[model samples]
Target: MNPVRKRRLVITLLILGAVAVATALSIFALQRNMTYLYSPSEVDAGKAPAAHPFRLGGIVKEGSVHRVPDTLTTEFVITDRFQSIPVTYTGILPDLFRVGQSTITTGSMVNGRFVATKVLAKHDATYMPPQVAQAIAKAKEAHRIPKAAQGGGAP
Candidate 1:
């Protein structure tokens, strides 16, 4: 084997190795930042991560919003029309936050309650965040009645 060719092959291998290491590190960093989104039903089923922060999306349950006077803390329940999860936030809420509103809150679950660090409310009646809409749709599909159960049997 020629000396020049041997050195060229070594350099090529080093470049490829560096690329692989960089790609692996990039993915690891991104995983730390990635937050999974879950619906109320999923949370009820114990599918939410115990310690890691995640996004919870659904409609704010009617008459569930509670505020403590002279404090920034608030509590509410979010429901996908199938199940509900209580959420607590100790910060100023968005002006758009209200009962019967579609919302997405980011935080971790603790003792059966979601401790939210950020709460995002839908801006308009006709518009829901895409993730929240998808979660609600999924929950509805999961709980839909079967055709046979609905008395639509085959002929």
Candidate 2:
């Protein structure tokens, strides 16, 4: 090959390699920062990542909210009607956070309990996060179906 052509080929290959490396690094960073949402039942069934932070979505179980006197730490149970997970938060909770309200908490499971880093509550009585709604709907549907129909019985 001519000297000029060889140099051009090398430069093009270097540019392509750099682009590929940049793309791979971008993907890795995004994946590390991404957190997935899971329902109470999914967490109960061990579907949520045990070591990574994730969002837990469901209704706050009625009468489950508890706060330590003179402290910001609060504990509550989040339920999808079929299953429940206990969550603890140490920061100032949202004004809308209350029993029977839909909420999503970002945290990681520690010793079978969710230790939340942040908590988000629905802005209105009629509004729920789409992911939370879908998760609850799926749990409800699964509860309505019988074990036999769900292929859980003996053949």
Candidate 3:
């Protein structure tokens, strides 16, 4: 091959190889860390992966909020219309996590209870995060999620 043509072919092959490696690395990194958000109903339906780290969100069931006797730990129930999961957290809970309020707990469920490593509560009396509200709205549209009783009546 002509000298210049040989050099051009080498450079082209090197650039193609670099692109291939980058694509592979991107896929590998993506597969290493993946977590899904679930609602109480989704967890109950076995949609969540067992032993996989995941997050759950729902309203704190009425009368289900309680602090441990002498610890930063607290226990509560997250419920949607279809299901409820008991959550335990060993940290200061957000002030807005009162009965009938919304909160999200991050952890895994073990032996029928949600063992939360961290819990975040909504700050306002009537606030739902936009992403969560959208999920709820979509669920509502599907008519696939049950409507829970709220304020003594069906929501």
Q: Which candidate number has the best TM-score?
A: 2
Candidate 1 residue lDDT tens string, 1-155: 89999999999999999999999999898984564578998887877777688899999999898997899999999999999999999997788888888899999888888999999987654666888888877656655655334432221
lDDT of 2 by residue, 37-150 (tens): 789988888878887899999999998999988998999999999999999999988888888888999999888899999999976546678888888778667766764465
Candidate 1: C-alpha lDDT: 0.85
Q: Which of 1 and 2 is the better model by lDDT? A: 2
lDDT per model vs. reference: 0.85, 0.87, 0.82
Tens digits of per-residue lDDT for model 3, 1-155: 99999999999999999999999998778863554468988888888879687899888988888888989888888998689999888987776668877788899988899999988776654577788888876756556444552333213
Model 3 misplacement above 4 A:
1-36, 123-155
Q: Please give the lDDT score at residue 92 for candidate 2.
A: 88
- Alpha-carbon error at 14 in model 1, in Å? 31
Using lDDT as the measure, which candidate wins? 2
Itemize residue pairs with steric clashes in candidate 2.
none
Error of 3 at 89 (Å): 0.9
Supply the global lDDT for candidate 3.
0.82
* Per-model C-alpha RMSD: 8.8, 9.6, 9.5
Order of candidate numbers by lDDT, starting with the best: 2, 1, 3
Q: TM-score per candidate, in order?
A: 0.56, 0.57, 0.56
List clash counts for every candidate, in order. 0, 0, 0
